[model samples]
Target: MPIGLAPTVRSKFEHHKIDEAALDGAPMFDLPFNPGVQIRGYSAINQPNCQIIIEDFMPGTEFDWTFVHDEMQYCISGEMEVEVSLPPLYMETTKAHITPGTVFSYPVGARKHVKVIGDAPFRHLCFCPPSPDYPFPTLEQLKGS
Candidate 1:
Protein backbone atom coordinates (compact mmCIF):
# COMPACT_ATOMS: atom_id res chain seq x y z
CA MET A 1 0.00 0.00 0.00
CA PRO A 2 0.98 3.63 -0.27
CA ILE A 3 1.73 4.03 3.44
CA GLY A 4 4.25 1.12 3.20
CA LEU A 5 3.44 -0.88 6.35
CA ALA A 6 0.80 -2.20 8.68
CA PRO A 7 1.08 -1.30 12.36
CA THR A 8 3.93 0.99 11.54
CA VAL A 9 7.03 0.38 13.63
CA ARG A 10 8.91 3.65 13.33
CA SER A 11 9.48 6.44 10.88
CA LYS A 12 11.94 5.72 8.09
CA PHE A 13 13.94 8.64 9.38
CA GLU A 14 14.41 7.10 12.81
CA HIS A 15 17.94 6.63 14.11
CA HIS A 16 19.59 5.74 17.40
CA LYS A 17 18.54 8.71 19.49
CA ILE A 18 19.54 9.86 22.93
CA ASP A 19 17.27 8.80 25.74
CA GLU A 20 14.43 11.22 26.39
CA ALA A 21 14.91 10.62 30.11
CA ALA A 22 18.31 12.21 29.76
CA LEU A 23 16.63 15.51 28.98
CA ASP A 24 14.69 15.50 32.25
CA GLY A 25 16.85 18.27 33.62
CA ALA A 26 16.62 20.44 30.51
CA PRO A 27 15.21 23.91 31.00
CA MET A 28 11.61 24.58 30.12
CA PHE A 29 10.19 27.62 28.41
CA ASP A 30 6.74 29.17 28.35
CA LEU A 31 6.44 28.82 24.60
CA PRO A 32 5.07 31.68 22.53
CA PHE A 33 1.39 31.84 21.51
CA ASN A 34 -1.42 30.17 23.47
CA PRO A 35 -0.92 32.80 26.14
CA GLY A 36 -2.41 32.07 29.56
CA VAL A 37 -2.38 28.38 28.72
CA GLN A 38 0.01 26.35 30.82
CA ILE A 39 2.02 25.10 27.86
CA ARG A 40 5.71 24.40 28.31
CA GLY A 41 8.51 23.08 26.11
CA TYR A 42 12.17 22.15 26.23
CA SER A 43 14.59 21.29 23.52
CA ALA A 44 15.45 17.61 23.35
CA ILE A 45 17.57 17.78 20.20
CA ASN A 46 19.43 20.81 18.93
CA GLN A 47 21.27 19.80 15.80
CA PRO A 48 22.62 22.05 13.05
CA ASN A 49 19.86 21.23 10.54
CA CYS A 50 16.98 20.46 12.84
CA GLN A 51 15.74 20.41 16.39
CA ILE A 52 13.15 18.53 18.43
CA ILE A 53 11.23 19.30 21.56
CA ILE A 54 8.84 17.73 23.95
CA GLU A 55 5.96 20.12 24.52
CA ASP A 56 2.98 19.79 26.76
CA PHE A 57 -0.20 21.79 26.85
CA MET A 58 -2.40 21.73 29.90
CA PRO A 59 -6.03 20.77 29.38
CA GLY A 60 -8.15 23.31 27.52
CA THR A 61 -5.23 25.17 26.03
CA GLU A 62 -5.54 26.34 22.42
CA PHE A 63 -2.76 27.28 20.03
CA ASP A 64 -3.82 28.95 16.76
CA TRP A 65 -1.24 30.37 14.43
CA THR A 66 0.70 30.07 11.19
CA PHE A 67 3.91 28.17 10.76
CA VAL A 68 7.31 29.75 10.27
CA HIS A 69 9.03 26.41 9.64
CA ASP A 70 8.25 23.16 7.93
CA GLU A 71 7.55 20.69 10.71
CA MET A 72 6.16 17.39 11.89
CA GLN A 73 4.59 16.35 15.20
CA TYR A 74 3.82 13.05 16.88
CA CYS A 75 1.47 12.72 19.80
CA ILE A 76 3.19 11.12 22.75
CA SER A 77 0.13 11.21 25.01
CA GLY A 78 -3.23 12.85 25.62
CA GLU A 79 -5.45 14.16 22.83
CA MET A 80 -5.72 17.22 20.61
CA GLU A 81 -7.65 18.71 17.73
CA VAL A 82 -5.60 20.37 15.02
CA GLU A 83 -6.96 22.48 12.19
CA VAL A 84 -4.58 23.31 9.38
CA SER A 85 -4.99 25.30 6.20
CA LEU A 86 -2.64 26.32 3.46
CA PRO A 87 -1.79 29.97 3.24
CA PRO A 88 -2.31 32.76 0.64
CA LEU A 89 -5.68 32.81 2.40
CA TYR A 90 -6.30 30.43 5.27
CA MET A 91 -10.02 30.38 4.66
CA GLU A 92 -10.60 26.65 4.64
CA THR A 93 -9.72 24.30 7.53
CA THR A 94 -8.70 20.66 7.77
CA LYS A 95 -9.12 19.23 11.24
CA ALA A 96 -7.82 16.00 12.74
CA HIS A 97 -7.93 14.22 16.06
CA ILE A 98 -4.43 13.58 17.36
CA THR A 99 -3.90 10.58 19.61
CA PRO A 100 -0.92 8.44 20.50
CA GLY A 101 1.17 7.58 17.43
CA THR A 102 -0.61 10.18 15.32
CA VAL A 103 1.81 12.00 13.04
CA PHE A 104 1.12 15.15 11.12
CA SER A 105 3.00 17.84 9.23
CA TYR A 106 2.53 21.12 7.47
CA PRO A 107 4.58 23.26 5.19
CA VAL A 108 5.95 26.61 6.20
CA GLY A 109 3.26 29.33 6.23
CA ALA A 110 0.40 26.89 6.85
CA ARG A 111 -2.07 28.00 9.50
CA LYS A 112 -2.69 25.64 12.40
CA HIS A 113 -4.96 25.68 15.41
CA VAL A 114 -4.35 23.02 18.04
CA LYS A 115 -6.33 22.51 21.24
CA VAL A 116 -5.44 20.32 24.17
CA ILE A 117 -8.47 18.04 24.44
CA GLY A 118 -8.56 16.17 27.75
CA ASP A 119 -7.95 16.14 31.48
CA ALA A 120 -4.25 15.31 31.35
CA PRO A 121 -1.74 17.48 29.59
CA PHE A 122 -1.63 17.02 25.81
CA ARG A 123 1.96 16.19 25.02
CA HIS A 124 3.66 15.80 21.64
CA LEU A 125 7.11 15.60 20.15
CA CYS A 126 7.74 18.18 17.49
CA PHE A 127 10.56 18.39 14.93
CA CYS A 128 11.61 21.22 12.72
CA PRO A 129 14.59 22.29 10.66
CA PRO A 130 16.54 25.02 12.38
CA SER A 131 16.61 28.43 10.79
CA PRO A 132 18.55 31.51 11.78
CA ASP A 133 15.67 33.74 10.64
CA TYR A 134 13.41 32.37 13.38
CA PRO A 135 15.41 30.62 16.04
CA PHE A 136 14.10 28.18 18.61
CA PRO A 137 13.78 29.19 22.26
CA THR A 138 16.99 29.25 24.20
CA LEU A 139 17.52 27.90 27.70
CA GLU A 140 18.02 31.46 28.89
CA GLN A 141 14.36 32.08 28.17
CA LEU A 142 13.36 29.51 30.80
CA LYS A 143 11.12 30.60 33.66
CA GLY A 144 9.63 28.97 36.72
CA SER A 145 6.02 27.94 36.50
Candidate 2:
Protein backbone atom coordinates (compact mmCIF):
# COMPACT_ATOMS: atom_id res chain seq x y z
CA MET A 1 0.00 0.00 0.00
CA PRO A 2 3.00 2.27 -0.21
CA ILE A 3 3.71 4.77 -2.99
CA GLY A 4 5.84 4.16 -6.09
CA LEU A 5 4.74 0.62 -6.72
CA ALA A 6 2.60 0.92 -9.88
CA PRO A 7 5.57 1.38 -12.16
CA THR A 8 7.00 -1.84 -10.87
CA VAL A 9 3.73 -3.57 -11.69
CA ARG A 10 3.64 -1.96 -15.11
CA SER A 11 7.21 -3.03 -15.80
CA LYS A 12 6.38 -6.56 -14.86
CA PHE A 13 3.72 -6.60 -17.58
CA GLU A 14 4.87 -7.31 -21.11
CA HIS A 15 5.82 -4.38 -23.26
CA HIS A 16 3.33 -3.70 -26.00
CA LYS A 17 3.72 -2.09 -29.40
CA ILE A 18 3.05 1.61 -29.87
CA ASP A 19 0.99 2.21 -32.92
CA GLU A 20 -1.97 4.25 -34.13
CA ALA A 21 -4.26 1.30 -33.72
CA ALA A 22 -3.16 0.86 -30.14
CA LEU A 23 -4.26 4.42 -29.54
CA ASP A 24 -7.61 4.08 -31.28
CA GLY A 25 -10.71 4.19 -29.09
CA ALA A 26 -8.62 5.41 -26.21
CA PRO A 27 -10.15 7.71 -23.60
CA MET A 28 -8.94 11.29 -23.89
CA PHE A 29 -9.54 14.62 -22.23
CA ASP A 30 -12.11 16.74 -24.00
CA LEU A 31 -12.35 20.29 -22.76
CA PRO A 32 -15.00 22.13 -24.77
CA PHE A 33 -12.69 23.69 -27.40
CA ASN A 34 -9.72 21.38 -27.09
CA PRO A 35 -9.73 17.96 -28.70
CA GLY A 36 -7.05 15.34 -28.19
CA VAL A 37 -6.61 11.72 -27.23
CA GLN A 38 -4.37 10.89 -24.32
CA ILE A 39 -2.87 7.60 -25.33
CA ARG A 40 -0.79 6.43 -22.40
CA GLY A 41 1.05 7.80 -19.40
CA TYR A 42 3.18 6.53 -16.57
CA SER A 43 4.35 7.77 -13.20
CA ALA A 44 8.11 7.92 -13.29
CA ILE A 45 10.04 6.10 -10.55
CA ASN A 46 6.84 4.78 -9.09
CA GLN A 47 3.76 6.58 -7.74
CA PRO A 48 4.46 10.04 -9.12
CA ASN A 49 7.95 11.44 -9.34
CA CYS A 50 7.40 12.40 -12.97
CA GLN A 51 4.88 11.57 -15.67
CA ILE A 52 4.90 10.88 -19.36
CA ILE A 53 1.84 11.24 -21.58
CA ILE A 54 1.26 10.62 -25.27
CA GLU A 55 -1.42 12.69 -26.94
CA ASP A 56 -3.06 12.81 -30.35
CA PHE A 57 -4.40 16.18 -31.37
CA MET A 58 -7.23 16.58 -33.81
CA PRO A 59 -7.06 19.11 -36.60
CA GLY A 60 -7.82 22.67 -35.50
CA THR A 61 -7.91 21.54 -31.90
CA GLU A 62 -5.49 22.70 -29.23
CA PHE A 63 -4.34 22.05 -25.70
CA ASP A 64 -4.74 25.36 -23.92
CA TRP A 65 -2.36 27.31 -21.74
CA THR A 66 -1.38 25.61 -18.52
CA PHE A 67 1.69 25.59 -16.32
CA VAL A 68 3.60 22.54 -15.29
CA HIS A 69 6.57 21.64 -13.11
CA ASP A 70 8.62 20.96 -16.30
CA GLU A 71 7.99 19.45 -19.67
CA MET A 72 9.65 17.81 -22.67
CA GLN A 73 7.91 16.74 -25.82
CA TYR A 74 8.55 14.93 -29.07
CA CYS A 75 6.44 14.80 -32.20
CA ILE A 76 5.85 11.24 -33.20
CA SER A 77 3.19 11.30 -35.91
CA GLY A 78 2.09 14.67 -37.31
CA GLU A 79 2.41 18.46 -37.37
CA MET A 80 1.59 21.16 -34.84
CA GLU A 81 1.95 24.79 -33.87
CA VAL A 82 3.03 25.48 -30.31
CA GLU A 83 2.73 28.69 -28.35
CA VAL A 84 4.44 29.10 -25.03
CA SER A 85 4.12 31.78 -22.37
CA LEU A 86 6.71 32.28 -19.66
CA PRO A 87 6.01 33.66 -16.23
CA PRO A 88 7.61 36.57 -14.31
CA LEU A 89 8.37 38.04 -17.76
CA TYR A 90 4.91 37.29 -19.22
CA MET A 91 6.69 36.82 -22.53
CA GLU A 92 5.15 34.65 -25.20
CA THR A 93 7.14 32.69 -27.76
CA THR A 94 5.50 30.77 -30.49
CA LYS A 95 6.67 27.92 -32.65
CA ALA A 96 4.38 28.62 -35.58
CA HIS A 97 4.99 25.29 -37.19
CA ILE A 98 6.38 21.92 -36.21
CA THR A 99 6.42 18.64 -38.05
CA PRO A 100 6.84 15.01 -37.22
CA GLY A 101 10.03 13.89 -35.49
CA THR A 102 10.62 17.17 -33.73
CA VAL A 103 11.57 17.27 -30.07
CA PHE A 104 11.62 20.07 -27.54
CA SER A 105 11.76 20.77 -23.81
CA TYR A 106 10.41 23.53 -21.62
CA PRO A 107 11.14 24.87 -18.18
CA VAL A 108 9.19 24.18 -15.00
CA GLY A 109 6.94 27.20 -15.09
CA ALA A 110 6.14 27.53 -18.75
CA ARG A 111 2.57 27.91 -19.98
CA LYS A 112 1.98 26.22 -23.30
CA HIS A 113 -0.62 25.67 -26.00
CA VAL A 114 -0.64 23.21 -28.86
CA LYS A 115 -2.57 23.34 -32.14
CA VAL A 116 -2.86 20.69 -34.78
CA ILE A 117 -3.33 21.25 -38.47
CA GLY A 118 -4.39 19.40 -41.62
CA ASP A 119 -6.44 16.20 -41.76
CA ALA A 120 -3.89 14.15 -39.90
CA PRO A 121 -3.73 14.08 -36.13
CA PHE A 122 -0.71 15.32 -34.20
CA ARG A 123 0.80 12.74 -31.92
CA HIS A 124 3.39 13.60 -29.32
CA LEU A 125 4.80 12.51 -26.01
CA CYS A 126 5.10 14.85 -23.03
CA PHE A 127 7.32 14.62 -19.94
CA CYS A 128 6.78 16.53 -16.74
CA PRO A 129 8.43 16.49 -13.40
CA PRO A 130 6.47 15.29 -10.41
CA SER A 131 5.76 18.04 -7.95
CA PRO A 132 2.96 18.30 -5.43
CA ASP A 133 2.37 21.91 -6.37
CA TYR A 134 2.30 21.54 -10.14
CA PRO A 135 -0.22 24.14 -11.34
CA PHE A 136 -1.78 21.74 -13.77
CA PRO A 137 -3.64 18.95 -12.07
CA THR A 138 -1.92 15.59 -12.00
CA LEU A 139 -3.44 12.52 -13.63
CA GLU A 140 -1.51 10.25 -11.29
CA GLN A 141 -4.52 9.65 -9.07
CA LEU A 142 -6.52 8.60 -12.12
CA LYS A 143 -4.52 5.41 -12.21
CA GLY A 144 -7.06 4.55 -9.55
CA SER A 145 -9.35 7.54 -9.77
Candidate 3:
Protein backbone atom coordinates (compact mmCIF):
# COMPACT_ATOMS: atom_id res chain seq x y z
CA MET A 1 0.00 0.00 0.00
CA PRO A 2 1.17 3.53 -0.82
CA ILE A 3 2.20 5.59 2.19
CA GLY A 4 -0.26 8.43 2.74
CA LEU A 5 -1.85 10.85 5.15
CA ALA A 6 -5.49 11.71 5.40
CA PRO A 7 -6.94 15.17 5.96
CA THR A 8 -8.23 15.61 9.49
CA VAL A 9 -11.92 16.22 9.86
CA ARG A 10 -13.94 16.93 12.96
CA SER A 11 -17.18 14.99 13.20
CA LYS A 12 -20.22 17.20 13.33
CA PHE A 13 -21.88 14.78 15.75
CA GLU A 14 -18.94 15.06 18.14
CA HIS A 15 -19.62 17.94 20.46
CA HIS A 16 -19.58 19.00 24.10
CA LYS A 17 -21.56 21.52 26.13
CA ILE A 18 -21.33 22.86 29.69
CA ASP A 19 -24.11 24.87 31.27
CA GLU A 20 -22.54 27.34 33.68
CA ALA A 21 -25.72 27.53 35.72
CA ALA A 22 -25.75 23.76 36.08
CA LEU A 23 -22.28 23.91 37.55
CA ASP A 24 -23.53 25.96 40.49
CA GLY A 25 -23.19 23.91 43.70
CA ALA A 26 -21.14 21.37 41.80
CA PRO A 27 -18.76 19.42 43.97
CA MET A 28 -15.38 21.12 43.94
CA PHE A 29 -12.29 19.60 45.42
CA ASP A 30 -9.14 21.03 46.91
CA LEU A 31 -5.95 21.31 44.91
CA PRO A 32 -2.76 19.89 46.41
CA PHE A 33 -0.76 22.23 48.66
CA ASN A 34 -3.62 24.70 48.37
CA PRO A 35 -6.47 23.20 50.31
CA GLY A 36 -9.57 25.34 50.93
CA VAL A 37 -9.38 26.93 47.47
CA GLN A 38 -12.27 25.25 45.67
CA ILE A 39 -12.21 24.34 41.99
CA ARG A 40 -14.34 22.58 39.39
CA GLY A 41 -13.75 21.47 35.83
CA TYR A 42 -15.39 19.55 32.99
CA SER A 43 -13.15 16.72 31.92
CA ALA A 44 -15.02 16.17 28.66
CA ILE A 45 -13.69 19.54 27.57
CA ASN A 46 -10.25 18.46 28.68
CA GLN A 47 -8.98 16.49 25.78
CA PRO A 48 -5.60 14.93 25.22
CA ASN A 49 -4.35 18.34 24.10
CA CYS A 50 -5.80 20.77 26.65
CA GLN A 51 -7.52 21.36 29.99
CA ILE A 52 -9.93 23.97 31.31
CA ILE A 53 -10.43 24.63 35.02
CA ILE A 54 -12.57 27.09 36.94
CA GLU A 55 -11.64 28.17 40.45
CA ASP A 56 -13.10 30.02 43.41
CA PHE A 57 -10.63 31.37 45.93
CA MET A 58 -11.71 32.44 49.40
CA PRO A 59 -10.56 35.79 50.67
CA GLY A 60 -7.04 35.58 52.17
CA THR A 61 -6.57 32.12 50.71
CA GLU A 62 -3.37 31.29 48.85
CA PHE A 63 -1.71 28.42 47.08
CA ASP A 64 1.46 27.45 45.24
CA TRP A 65 1.28 25.80 41.85
CA THR A 66 4.02 24.52 39.58
CA PHE A 67 2.73 23.92 36.07
CA VAL A 68 3.75 20.80 34.21
CA HIS A 69 2.35 22.22 30.98
CA ASP A 70 2.10 25.71 29.52
CA GLU A 71 -0.80 27.56 31.18
CA MET A 72 -2.83 30.75 30.97
CA GLN A 73 -5.11 32.10 33.68
CA TYR A 74 -7.66 34.88 33.36
CA CYS A 75 -9.33 36.52 36.29
CA ILE A 76 -13.09 36.44 35.81
CA SER A 77 -14.20 38.15 39.00
CA GLY A 78 -12.92 39.99 42.06
CA GLU A 79 -9.10 40.26 42.26
CA MET A 80 -6.02 38.43 43.47
CA GLU A 81 -2.42 39.12 44.43
CA VAL A 82 -0.03 36.88 42.54
CA GLU A 83 3.66 36.22 42.96
CA VAL A 84 5.22 34.38 40.05
CA SER A 85 8.68 32.86 40.05
CA LEU A 86 10.86 30.70 37.89
CA PRO A 87 12.55 27.68 39.44
CA PRO A 88 15.92 28.11 41.21
CA LEU A 89 18.95 29.07 39.00
CA TYR A 90 16.52 30.85 36.64
CA MET A 91 15.11 32.92 39.53
CA GLU A 92 12.95 35.51 37.74
CA THR A 93 10.04 36.69 39.87
CA THR A 94 7.14 39.14 39.71
CA LYS A 95 4.23 40.33 41.83
CA ALA A 96 0.98 41.72 40.54
CA HIS A 97 -2.62 42.38 41.49
CA ILE A 98 -4.89 40.75 38.94
CA THR A 99 -8.51 41.71 38.63
CA PRO A 100 -11.27 41.03 36.16
CA GLY A 101 -9.86 41.28 32.63
CA THR A 102 -6.36 40.51 33.87
CA VAL A 103 -4.68 37.56 32.20
CA PHE A 104 -1.30 35.85 32.27
CA SER A 105 0.60 32.83 31.05
CA TYR A 106 3.62 30.78 32.10
CA PRO A 107 5.88 28.28 30.43
CA VAL A 108 5.98 24.63 31.43
CA GLY A 109 7.09 24.10 35.05
CA ALA A 110 6.86 27.74 36.21
CA ARG A 111 5.84 28.23 39.85
CA LYS A 112 3.21 30.66 41.12
CA HIS A 113 1.97 31.75 44.51
CA VAL A 114 -1.43 33.44 44.50
CA LYS A 115 -3.56 35.02 47.21
CA VAL A 116 -7.14 36.19 46.86
CA ILE A 117 -7.15 39.89 47.73
CA GLY A 118 -10.66 41.16 48.44
CA ASP A 119 -13.87 40.61 50.43
CA ALA A 120 -15.53 38.82 47.53
CA PRO A 121 -14.42 35.40 46.35
CA PHE A 122 -11.94 35.45 43.49
CA ARG A 123 -12.88 33.53 40.40
CA HIS A 124 -10.71 32.61 37.42
CA LEU A 125 -10.48 30.40 34.39
CA CYS A 126 -7.37 28.39 33.69
CA PHE A 127 -6.41 26.96 30.32
CA CYS A 128 -3.50 24.65 29.64
CA PRO A 129 -2.24 21.64 27.77
CA PRO A 130 -2.54 18.29 29.54
CA SER A 131 0.62 17.21 31.34
CA PRO A 132 2.81 14.69 29.54
CA ASP A 133 2.46 12.52 32.61
CA TYR A 134 -0.27 12.03 35.16
CA PRO A 135 -0.02 14.48 38.08
CA PHE A 136 3.39 15.82 36.95
CA PRO A 137 6.06 15.35 34.36
CA THR A 138 9.56 14.06 34.94
CA LEU A 139 12.57 16.42 34.97
CA GLU A 140 13.78 15.04 31.67
CA GLN A 141 10.31 15.39 30.15
CA LEU A 142 10.11 18.99 31.38
CA LYS A 143 13.43 19.85 29.70
CA GLY A 144 11.97 19.05 26.27
CA SER A 145 13.99 18.25 23.17
Q: Which candidate is the best by TM-score?
A: 1
Worst 10 residues of 2 by lDDT: 38-47
Q: Kindly list the per-residue Cα lDDT of model 2 for residues 32-143, writing each as its tens digit.
A: 4334433233222222545555566777676775564677778887788888877767576756578888888777677778777888778776666553322322233433
Which lDDT tens digits does candidate 3 get at residues 9-118?
Answer: 33233244434443444455577766567654333234455655555666777888887788887887878888888866448998898989988888887888888888
TM-score of 2: 0.63
Question: Which model, 1 or 3, shows the larger TM-score?
Answer: 1
Q: Which residue runs of candidate 3 sit more than 4 Å off their true CA positions?
A: 1-18, 35-37, 40-44, 88-90, 131-145
Q: For residues 32-104, what per-residue lDDT tens digits would candidate 1 score against the true structure?
A: 6755555556665566566777767778878787788898888888898888998778877798999998998
Better of 1 and 2 by TM-score: 1
What is the model-wide C-alpha lDDT for candidate 3?
Answer: 0.64
- Model 2 stretches astray by more than 4 angstroms: 1-16, 32-47, 131-145
Each candidate structure's TM-score, on Cα atoms with residue i matched to residue i, is 0.70, 0.63, 0.69
Q: Model 3, poorest ten-residue lDDT window?
A: 133-142
Runs of candidate 1 with Cα error greater than 4 angstroms are: 1-29, 131-145
Relative to the true structure, candidate 3 reaches a TM of: 0.69
